[model samples]
Target chain A: MGRLSDRAAFEQYAAQAEQRWETLWSGDRWVISVGISECSIAKGALETYRHLELLLSDGHIPAVLRRVGCAGWCFAEPFVEIKLPGQPPIVYGWVTTDRVPDLLDALRRGELRPEWALGVRAGESWQGIPALRDHPFLRSQRRLLLEQAGIIDPESIDDYIATGGYRAFLKALFEMTPEEVVNEVKTSNLRGRGGAGFPTGIKWESGRRTPAWPKYVVVNSHEGEPNVFKDRRLLETNPHLVLEGLLIGCYALETPHGYNYIGGEHALALRRFQKAVEQAYELGLLGDNILGSGFSCHVRVRTGGGAYICGEGSALMYAIMGQRGQPRTKPPRSVEEGLWKRPTVLNNTETFASIPAIIRNGGSWYAALGTKESTGTKLVTMQGPVRYLGVAEIELGMPMRQLIFEVFGGLRDGYRFKGVQTGGVSAGPLREEELDVPVDFDALTPLGAMLGSGGFVVFDDTVCAVDFARYLVAFSRYESCGKCTPCRLGTPALVEILDRIRHGFGRPEDLDVIQYASKHIIDLSLCGLGQVAPMPLLGMLERFREEFIEHITERRCRAGVCPMTAAAPIAS
Target chain B: MEPTKSGQRVDLEPLRRVLEERFRPRDYREAQELVVGACQEAQRLFGWVPPEAAQLIAEHLGVTTNRIYGLLTFYADFRTEPPGRHFLWICHGAACYVAGAGRLVEFLQERYGITGQGTTPDGALTVHVFNGCLGVCDLAPFAQLDHHEYVGRLNLERLQALIAELQGEAQTEAADGSTE
Candidate 1:
């Protein structure tokens, strides 16, 4: 099923694609899938996959092996799935190279080694192993963006077209008006997933309202902030969904062009998204007069030069414009005067990807899912000492305590949970007391932690707050766009103070100095980068003040992680 | 002077392929839309964005050389100088930091005498402590070897072993060269 030339052509293609998808998914042959995700490759998934490929194709073990994207099962990577004709897909974790033959032998015998099995997809049990629905980590998650990640073959356009991927864009183009689509998104109450929780519909409407000749839509896949892996992974998992969403937004706004501003480090994702773009054009899902509509769409994939500041709206536009990625103050948001002063609607990979779901199920259906203010599920990446160190999509109102303890299976048995740095590097490692707070976009701000990009790195007993604070502060200083005086000057000054404190040369008055500097940096800063530059330090100081005091007065490293020397204040 | 590190004249021929193939911006507006791609291709063709390549980009796009150099300096991905034979990106993301990336970093500095962002003495490797998560936090406290291969669950011993292996490979290469 190639290009849908017209409405009838699209319908025929959709029906055939659905049938093809069904045949492929629940087909007669035994299908073996290994994820080609970065996380999977890191854990030696390729080697296992190669071994499996040889084993499956050798004719002794009759099966087919294909590559898929990471299913967000970080704790158990190199996981393999075996799907028989009648049975559900059986997922087994820790499928190392040596274990491939053993797994095949067991599969041949029509038995699953319950020890190796994580769960069974599409069914309740594979002999003894439980269903994925009953999975400990997966139970809480309302996965909209990551729903088809592990199951679908990310590199295949056929898999996407089969699994109800581009239907929303097609529907929007053929069935609904631009106004209706925009209204649906507005009704869904979907806020921007890329840090700033601005209403996505509002951002789009602003772009639509502007009489700019040519408007642009951006899928900000620049997962620049430290600890945020969701955007890149989402793109890698299913680039088509993101593209479809982008096209939908374009259709809603009647725009011609869209840009996928992918990070430089995310080479695999860039390639996949670029591939998806090519496939879309070939299928006529993208390009001029989609299903014979006047709305012509062309997506350009722009690889970032790895600036964290470019993730900022103005800086991103500036970077795209061949200008320095320095932020000019925003009265004219990207939707007003963006990308060479044209109206541009920029949303993150998560936000754009979620658009399909919102459009498919009307706006009210989405609005009813999450909190009153913060609607819809969020793609959150959990890292550090958590048992399941991966990404999971959770509802907005889910508590931090539940996310870390229940969903992620808490830290390791021996370690005590100290804190968790939610959002980004600028946000906190929130203390144990602050764990009960909801992971809402609006609610997390007051606690000095926002659901910014939805990546929360938990800190166990081993982490020394002062040292961690210093690392984060120094990182901010390093990444500071020299455009702002506060971030440029203040971050380095804060780093110095933290460094002094870490090295055991800190004076008692150093705390006051940090407080004063932090105030100026937070208050005087231009963009979010400068405003939140001192946040990690401030959050650390608020929660773990004793650690700092101990480092200062006693010259003691309580965690024994720091090199605290009882010396005079280090000269700047 | 070191061949790769020194400010010697490079062959500008390969840069033309990257420019022609990757970009085809019709006008200045189109060029403006594709600045990042142009710079990225320029960097990829040459190991780093040399002054010559920057000049070419500026000329091609009808922009100032300052703009190109500004981008090269601003983004952490681009380097003005040519990098070492191999790139070692040690992730210092929050996950890695909590999992003792500091210790591994200290170990590299102490054991191999690697300092800051500079290349090793023999020019075999250069250490890049990445500003953020490289999206492989599953393997925390990890270092990406040669940009693709990930050395997971990294510790002092594993790091030492990895260094020995690289050195062994280098010695083999050197011996092969001598034979040739």
Candidate 2:
């Protein structure tokens, strides 16, 4: 291959070095990348890794074992991928330690066991085996944000570079003016994936136009929303991408300081991101005078003390500033006054992660991929009772029916679909009839639902709507920051009524009180946490009024989830 | 409110020394930046922030002790009372809850005889501290022992096995310490 003469020899040298290293590690020898996720660990995946490594070190196998992050198809974790010379890499799932010998035997014989094989990766289908893209779990997904997940060595910057990473950041820095980059994003119509569906371009423009010096760009990587692990996945599996996006955002907004506030509970993700930050700094992609473009930026990777309100923009800023993570009163929005009262731009983990790709492929190209209103793919976590429960990246506006049935392979076992709590705990539940609704921000908004961070938690026939609603309300009550009266008092009051109804002590007026409280909480709460807290309960009441009535009149919970219905009364 | 083994109140001098070395703040507002940091340091040292820690930090920052306590109580990760040797954080996120994290929480509470989201009676474990989301929804019903290690796709049986394993480890460590 002739080297392109347009670039300097050093660029070519770096590219060749990375290519040679990848080929040496992957192409000629057995390269085994095992998926290291918490799910896999629960299934004794670390033991399996140790066994494999032991075998390799003992000269029983000629292979390399690299620990990678989540494969996303989590139902079949303890996932392993093996690359043999002159052959496509083969992925296998549910790899127990006992199966290690069999796997190694297959590798030695140049044959794959079809029983454990998920599939060869796309464009590399060996024999008659289907491609990974053709797998039933993955077929409907349009994986944009999750493009390199489970396929690359997340720790290796060279591996990421070999797969065409960081080009977008370089292009943004050298080629495009800050205004042009902002306009391109605006033209792309990329909305904030961190709920509210605010246009990213407009948010950036606001930060840019704000007449404040030392503007800050913050990444909200705290995935505290219930059932939402997509941000953690991105941070752990492809941290460099998130870093690149942050760098690109800084370049666009002309901000010199950036902070990635990660959840403290996520130790692995935090460590991975910390390492990626160090790598970026070492590469001169971060720190002062980044890439010698006269544009300098430094990113601080801070960990949150596990407050859900810290996911809120203003609260996140306060947490970064080492204060109590209570929501700030608006009018001076985060864009105008944030992070020590500077003009700061805050975006979610997935939103910032999507920036690099948006810069790489032109704004219009990304805009054309998804629906007109919701332009771009969204990474959604489909957990609870699904056959293949994990995160999937789907083009925005894909029907909920298609996602539930086609992508997730429907609910596990014989469990009939009861309902789903889309977005986070805050968003209302959608019934079986509402499954046809497009999983878009605007479309779900009118239904009193939102695509908030794309947590699609499916419920089965065994789930009691009352118990589930009580659980969500209780969660909100417990997690409320209590800065304002509505959230502090209102959430506890809502929980009390919900708890009373679940305990079969509901007065009919309690329902009205709940409804009244829901409206007022939404109206009076100062922050998004308190505002959206009532939606789940309200949604459950609206859709499953019979469930509430059954609990009240019949004093029977069909799903057998409520304690009072199942047992005798406690001393009250 | 816990007393020392020698039948005296636990000394705050060592803790004060550590805090002084780690963070010597000049003023109250300036110390706001070290609120989370100080709490983390306290957690690392004592496994939880005692009332004395609040007082010490408040004094160091030139703020009211209530302010330090307010910040500590606001963040969920900070524990006030001393925990058992191990902290068990179960994610009751929508997915994990639906995948039986509720059952796990119930089972631990019932089996270990713990209540009110605190340490077990024997101080072997803290059973009922629920986390927001472990961010590993792919592994539903995720559980974390201590603050670092993750155990996912947890059922009661697996949780039982993990707890037993932790108890065993703690026993071994105790034995080693006593011998020393």
Candidate 3:
């Protein structure tokens, strides 16, 4: 009964943290955790948390209330997890302030009622609630990056240490050479998760090989993509995991300086990450002679000014340098000449987050998870009208249909399954029949369905193909940085053409003009942003030509989305 | 608010202190790197970059006033002109588009009497079509109120209520700044 009194002591730092974790979860006291990321906070998570804390703060229930990161369950947000002594945790969703007292009362009575609970997680079912592994949304996902989300107090370095966070970095720092670390990542075959799918190991190898001193590591945490939120979620929930991964990268490259370029809009994430960095510094995990290993690494958090282009490699560096966040033409590609024209290791937040797991287990162990070409699990955020909408980590080779139908429970009751916008809004929509295709970057790119950042914006059948394509083209036109002529001019031209077609002014020859201009923009644009801008228009033109033809010839939007009657776009 | 000429005055004492304390640069080239950060800090303090404030930053950073002006003009985050007291941003990304943000945009434009980015005639509120996705598509058809609080699951009715609420707020916050 005295679980707290039976502490097994250890001298190692990670082992000491493990002991702390064991004591916390060893049924010494009841635990209450609330999801507190931006999404949940918007839905009154703070109010619910405050109410619950007030109720339990007196210690009358022998319970402790903790603030943890969100579990990517946006639909049922303001969720609260209650765990009794010797019982698995039960997550109650849609928990308002009014429900806090009732939940506390139930916990106080020593009988957790599961009628309002989402699921239970202790590797088995408890009460009437299903185990998390068996839950439909979680069943298909093998969560690695999000393994500790919602369970650990993200602001607490102790919780991170208990979960074996820096063991991988410690291993890399003490045992392995920088070459071995790069080789392990290369062996893991981890590609960039930030849309491009570049081989991360190869980039690391180059960063390692570049004969430059004072090498820098910049983790691009700026999520400028239209619909991707996985990076923010990672930063919020498992920031230490990403931090540990960053340390591994820095140690591998012998880098002394690191910068986390975060989006300014992500205030909560930035605050939490800044706190994590602070805690690590205090614990001797960061800064000179970390844990007395004679190796020093310092990480500073930098903020972006909400520029979409700043998420690009070169543009991100420029933004770090406090510029206008514009991209430059490549050739000295970041590895060779980056960050003040010095050799730099630039990778996405998710790419760095995957390092610890690869190093902890072998690189081959990480490689065995997904398809031969696209190995390792990917963090995918599904948006739109899906019933089970949220961010999730899924193995790379899973067919898109399983995620759409089986994992997410198809569209909501009234909506029909339309095409899924693979990658972000920048990539083209995959046809309904194309759902059978694997989500591998190479497998889908040939069909113009690159899994850019793994954000799938699913649309319902009610949306018109032409109008939707026109909107995507218009967004590209709006976000074009204007460094080059083709993207700056071509996006506007395509938008004008598409807008004309939607507004019943398109000529038959406009299609040919769009094709020619789109091809030129793809070929002539300076950066990847320009090259990818016309993808939706090009993809829609190829797959949904009939829809455009209908819009042009019959002057009709079959889905009733556009005016199609010579009416202005802003008509009330 | 932007500096209105012939002229309403803005004190540069506080900004000068900030530049000295936080943004003291080593050289001319490194000072160029501080352009965005300086402008960002200035925008936070004043809500929008006043030309005098830009000039002060220019002289402090040892760069030309035009350089700071170029940065302020280029980034979406910076606004050269004065902003309304209350800001309403509609998400214009793909998810919001599918969720009927365009309808909200049209309604907002018609009601506010401006498109793209503009303040109301009464100077109570500013409505801007946010350039990128605010990344909370879970609440598709969302808007950020004054930058942090998100008003999601929005319809025309809720947006009207919000605008009316903000206008009421600004009405109390008059030109003389008597209301606390």
Candidate 4:
């Protein structure tokens, strides 16, 4: 068999694999596929999986079962997808142990129950899936980030290969030099997706040129931001892409050790990631002399104990050292002093995933795909009142309105756009007036907001700015690591004042107090947490001062959304 | 491995059995440590771990309840609540206090008719306001529910809605037999 080249090669490989897959199905007389993601496990997907395994072992059914990752419809989990030789692939949602027999029977008869079949897959398009494409929740989505999700069996390396996986890594390793690899990334202008928009190549090159032995590459999957789901989806859907990036990173930085720091509560991501790492190691892709090359590196997976502070680079380093996750005063950053006090290059999963692509295609090619300042694609998790509430990989500097109206299918039904809380809770909210601004780090920063983690939370007119600010403040307060006085104490105090004002107890001077506290915390805090702690509240107060005063003076919430205060005297 | 000062012998057998029977079946090891770790964590959160908590851990770990409880008391992360439906955590830590989480805690006490980790008159909600940091300094003044969903910048009104929503959901789930 000749080596596969491109999409054509993939098609050929898919044809062959399909034939073999068909034979296995027809000869076996039964086949089962289960989505074994974290949420599914919690919902007894594993129990049902075990039950099927037992049935197969008992010779009650001849079947080959495979465990895949999340299909993105988390609301209905433990989703099962079945494909028989002559029958079309069908997906069943909310399957439990009690329903295993029915699923098995369906498999045996090659029958798909309409109630259980959430959708049918037809060459990258879905039908009979509740108007999935036109539905408000999924209307405006360009799913480059989630391209392979819910389609490929995440655990199968073959399935991944069949879908053009590792081609980028192989091309990078076999074809490009380390500096060339770095240059391509530089050209791509891919910034760090983990809140800070630090240019990824600069970080990589700095570590590469550090002249330090035992350099380290760290994958920050600690999605501590409350509203973000980009990294979670990436890890769950295409973990191998992350691993491939990590391997490339290890080669580029000449590092022997790599770690993926996943949040403790992200059970699904951790499971899939661990399996991917183990499989890679088994295939000799992760161990010494990978792909028969002289380069040698190994990857390790570490889990955080659900500390939001650990998402910060320094705090993440501390957590990996098995110590309390607290921020360290930085003169020597992670590029200088990181994990075990080594010169470490830390990039989030999304940032790392871009590297292989940059290497495979030239830097300029990747750069040409996006805007001049911000080159390459950015994975933005669109949430809140937006019609499409999932992750999408968009060209950087894409217009905000396009993302809001076209990509997100506009605001939810019967609601007008109030504003958007971009970059998660840490970012300042962007009002409707600022919606036309291009979505990039610099663009958002100039408007008193920032592109932090690419979490675009849409808000409609019904969302009260005071309550929104309060929600963000409360989130920040709970997630603050308490390493600094300002962040530790100032955030809660600000929340109280905001609460008082929202509850009709606000004095006019309270705004000044909040402003002072916001400035103090931003200036005095030890880490990113404190520095951006008051951003949401301050942003709202700055842009929507009338709303705040309305709550205090008239005891009314202008948006008619603040739960604490009464309606604004019925307008008359 | 040597046992800790608590006089609990380091029994790798139970751990190994659980790991083999449940986790290792799918070629997973060390990956499932979180299951065991969660038990120790629950204990740390609640002080005295409960048998049902251990059973829940076992259910997650794919092991027997007794084995899970043994591992729970053996290690340090499991906990059993005395009697409460709600776990209210107050952030007195630096970030939280700076963000006005203290006042929010006071507000909960004053308005909710429930203080600390006590149940409501209808036993529908239990409030547990503890002192800790949740790591969202930027969105400070936050609190968590059963370590799942986080509510930020809490006030009386938000708290009321949150409690009401939670109670309503709990009732609906009880009616539907859904495990939230």
Candidate 5:
């Protein structure tokens, strides 16, 4: 591997190497790839991998087993991709340990199982499985961040390199200076997708400026949003991309240590990440002087106990310090004093995953893709009433209506779209009137919603706003760290009032009580959880007050979704 | 692979070892504390009283099982098995019960083969009659399964269907041999 020390030299090397690399992997070899993403792991892909390893112990097979990330067909996991000489690579899904024997038999006999065959690979096609690409759930997706997912073995550096993995990192570290790297990110205008929407370049610069002995970079992989699986899907499917991004960050900041704070409940992801971290260390990509550069960096994995509040930056810092996962008051922001009192820059998994691409393509190229406010692509986890319910990456400022209808196939069963819940539990619910609103921090914030996290839960006409508000509050309340009075106590009161309202209890004044409490909680809370705790209730109240009034005064739920109100007699 | 004797009690020592190895900068004591917290969380998910779950966690954590067990029993969320496939927790505190939670519970009893505090004959549902504020008072009478909210009023038919749906999913996963 030749090294280039500038962009011009790097471009020349890349141009020459692209042709050479393509020729090398085009040779005859048996490629047996398995989707070992978190969902697949849950379906016992690890055991299947072990079985395959044992079965192929003899050299007669001449096959290499590789573990790739998710392929978006979560409903059918443990997908297997087989590439044999003179045959188009094929992918089979819904695989289990029991099915492995059958799969092996078919492979040996050169027979195909039509039922299991998801699709076929046609010369490096993204949609290896034709059916899967046409599947109602995946047809609308335009994969960018997930480009190499389900294609390359995440743990195998060779597989990653074979698919143009470290090329970006190499170009960034060896060719571009730290200042240039930072400048590219600045030009990209890529704001943080982790709720706050802070500029990534600004954060990097701020942390880089500190006179601290050692700066820290943390990948906030601890996704705790209910009904959201975007981050989880990314980490499960493309662990290496996230790692490469982290490595690029390390190089850009000249930091020595990085931490991936995985959610405690995500056992499968933890296992894969733990293995990936170890593999990175073994390959000398992690510890001490990576790729023969004087720069040295190592990444460690930390598991956070199931605390929703810990998803907040301050609380995440607390958990990393081995404290009870609780939020800390900000003033001495994390960039100044974080993780054992060090200058730390914490960005979400997706945020870090974008870094390598931004570096590879240059900032100007990346910035030109999305809206001015929100640059680059955004990975959104679509859930609930949507038909094509999965994760997809779309350009920022894409229309909410297009995302709901064109991308997610609209409300399931053609149910009228009532509203959409963006940014998970803490995000304010937006009505149909706001459906055309462009997705960006500036637009969403004024509408009393923040692009907290890229999680969109669609609701149909059948959904009851009163009920929905209550559900979110209950989730936030239970997950609260109880570090502050507003979140700890105020939330329960709001829950009680909502319960009363939903159960046909009378009191016009109770609405006033809810309004007062919601305002106070949002204003006085110490952290993001408390600040956003009242969002669901207040949003529902403002947008659908008639429903709440109907549940109380009329003793009936128009949606017929609420139990107490549903049982009430219909008006003549 | 050998099973340790029960009287011997699996130790929490290994948890500390694993934690210390993973968190290199942290000392053994700090590692043990972190492991304890993680174990406590795992116990809550299982809906079991912490002591037994803690012992198992101690084994994973490489610490004395007794030490882990002690920590488990200390937490509020940790529960010993009340024994039910569906952990039906109805909020019966001042807010919920006042807002017709009692009627909802009665409705559940009349419709499904459930009691106030026991599992159904087939172990499909376990209706735990407890009291707590489910936080969304403005909307009241709430119930949850494994901490995931199923809010917005409750009725006999909906409760039955919810239970059946959960049981069906569980059975399907089990039949596929995808779940432990």
Candidate 6:
């Protein structure tokens, strides 16, 4: 424990909190935490809260209502979990304001509606519903970063601290040396989850070796990845973990200054993170001489200007320096020469959020969890026809088949899984035959795919591969920073050819042009955005070549998605 | 380069002073920070960075106007022209596309005669130029009215209702011109 007794007091308080769990289950106080998200808010979560408030004012309902982040079951939002004394907490899904009175009445009667009951947790079953973890969607998930999600008040640092939040930082400060911390991370075998899978330990060691005054650490919370929400959810639910990780990185790198670059459009996430920062400062976890350990660090939250390129390391540094969001040429990577021409360390939100756990439990323990190459769990955002639409943290190397069919309950009605796109718009599609592929970075790399930001979307048979290719291609084209010629010109040309192919005007020669443009774009682009610009088109061409040929020869889209520009096929 | 107006030349002191205060420039080394400060101030104060405002920031920070303009243009959030009373952002992410966000975009374009990013002729709304993803993939086909407020699961009827609400609010604001 530190001199302030803060750590000791917190540990005691956490113990007390754990002890109070029995009280919560067997006492008079009833707690209800609604899983709140942008989706839940739109689904009238606020309305439900207001209805509860009205009930409370009427002196009818005798329970406290609290807001929590997404419970990883977004399909069930607005989710509500009710805890009554001496009984298992019953969770309800798809709850609405109109159902509040009935729910409260049932709760008053010590009963729950079976149809609405999703799960119960008290080492007992209720209405045929099993434990929350027993749900197929959550069974295989290894919740590390999201352990406290939908359970704690994110705005309350005391809640976070009482749950053993900053103990890892304290441990890093008092118990271990900076190099020891780096070695521990190395021992954990934690690779960067920021698509690249670079070793976190190596990045830190390099930054440590470089002697520079005022070295910098940056938290890349600018999650502009097309369909990924893991970072946003983590920030919204438990920002302190990320902050702790950033502090750890700072300590390891001996950097005094840090920056958290968040997307400007992420209003809720930004608000929650800002609140956490303020509370951390108030609790002395941040600011000068943090925890009286003589470790001083300052973290500034910089709102990104809504540029996707800013998510790139060098491009992000430029954005922070108030220049155009553009990437720098490599040979001297960001670790050596970064923001303000100083050695800098940058890690994604998920990579940073996992630090506390790695430090608390020995790094070797973490190393033993996942596969040989990729250690620890990965957060994946599942979309498309999956039954459950939410973020889940699963042990890496889990087969995509089990992730989609078993966990997400497979495709929805009238949909057969035709293909799945992992790693956002950049990575190529994996056909149904390739569903058994393990979702680790190295495993997917040989197939011309990467676990790029872990945005996985499943497509049905009805989905036009050509049209979907255009959609992903369009995202890359729109987001390309026009600094480089390959991305600037090549992506547009790719788009033009794709547009023509989709609209039934593609010539036999267009396919050759596409392959040519794609190869050149990957080879000549200045940055990742440009380099990956041709991926969607090329990936679709490689995997779904027949779809393109159908559009060209038959002048008929098998999925009926493309519009016909002319009645007859174009001259060969 | 933009020609300076007489009034702007005479009254550049207010904007210049604000830029200086925002940047806290110790010397020319801190010129880069001024670009962000100027852009943020312009968006917050004037709703857009006019060429004159960029010039003011440039002079105050001891940098060229092109430098400041380069940043404003490069960033998607910054706008050079004034926006209407309200702004709406309809996400076009992969999830949104799968959930029929294209229909919503087409609906907005055909009914309201607005395509991409444009201000309504009535000056009631200015939609962004592109239907960029706003990171709310869970709520596929979600839109942000103003900046912070999210409205999700949008359909034609729901979008019409939202537009009506916006138009009504704008009318009320116009009627009570004294209230900003």
Best by DockQ, which number?
1
The prediction achieving the highest lDDT against the true structure is 1
The CAPRI classification for model 6 reads as acceptable
Docking model 1 quality class: medium
DockQ of each: 0.78, 0.55, 0.58, 0.07, 0.09, 0.44
Candidate 1 vs candidate 6, TM-score winner? 1
- Predicted model with the maximum TM-score: 1
Which of candidates 2 and 6 reaches a greater lDDT? 2
Q: Of the true interface contacts, what fraction does each candidate have?
A: 0.87, 0.74, 0.60, 0.00, 0.02, 0.51
Q: Per-residue CA lDDT of candidate 3, range A255-340, in tens?
A: 87888989877878888899999888877778877766677899978887777888889988987776667899889899999998
The true-versus-predicted C-alpha distance at residue A245 of model 4, in Å, is: 1.1
- Candidate order, lDDT descending: 1, 3, 2, 6, 5, 4
Residue lDDT tens for model 1, A1-572? 46667878877877887897777777778888887788888888999998887766667755678888888888888898889778788888999889988988887888778899889885566578899878888888888888898888888887887888888887888889999999999999999999889999888888889997688888888888878888788878899999999999888888888888888899889999999999889888888887777768999888778778889988988887777788889787778888878888899888999999999999999999889999999988888878887888898899989988888888877888888887787677688888889988888888888788888888887889999898888888888889879889999899888877878888899999999999999999999888988888888898899999999889987898887755654564
lDDT of 6 by residue, A1-572 (tens): 22233556546655765666545546777788887766678678888878777887865556677887876777888888888765677889888998988988887886678689778864656667687878888888999888888887777676677677887988888899999999999999999988888999999999998887779999999888677877888888888889889988888877678889888777678888888887777666778877567788888777777788899999999988878889989959888899999898999999999999999998999999879989998888888867887888989899989989887788888777788877787778888887788988788877767788888878777678888888888778878888888888888788888888877888888899988889999999998777887786777788999989988887788887666675655664
- Compared with the true structure, what per-residue lDDT tens digits does model 2 show for residues B2-67? 222222355677677877896776655447766677777667776777777677777776667777
Candidate 2, after superposition: displacement of residue A65 in Å?
2.7
Q: Give the per-residue lDDT digits (tens) of candidate 4, residues A1-572.
A: 43233434544665676666556556635456787654455456788888878877877665577777765554456777766656556677778788878877865674556677666554443344443344333444444446677667777666776666777776776777778778778877888888788899899989887777778899999887766766877888789888888988887787778989887656667878898888777655667766565677888777775567878999888766545678899969889888777899999998888776677667788878667877777887665545543456777887898877877667657777777777677767777777889887788897788888887667666667887788788768866777689998999999899778776777889989998988999999999878988988888887888888888888888766555543444233
Over 4 Å off, model 6: A1-27, A568-572, B1-38, B41-47, B50-65, B106-115, B129-132, B155-180
Which parts of model 4 have CA positions greater than 4 angstroms off? A1-66, A73-142, A414-416, A559-572, B1-180
lDDT of 5 at A516: 93
Higher lDDT: candidate 4 or 5? 5
lDDT of 6 at B64: 85
lDDT of 5 by residue, A317-390 (tens): 77766556677888788888887778888999999889888888888988887788788888876655455545
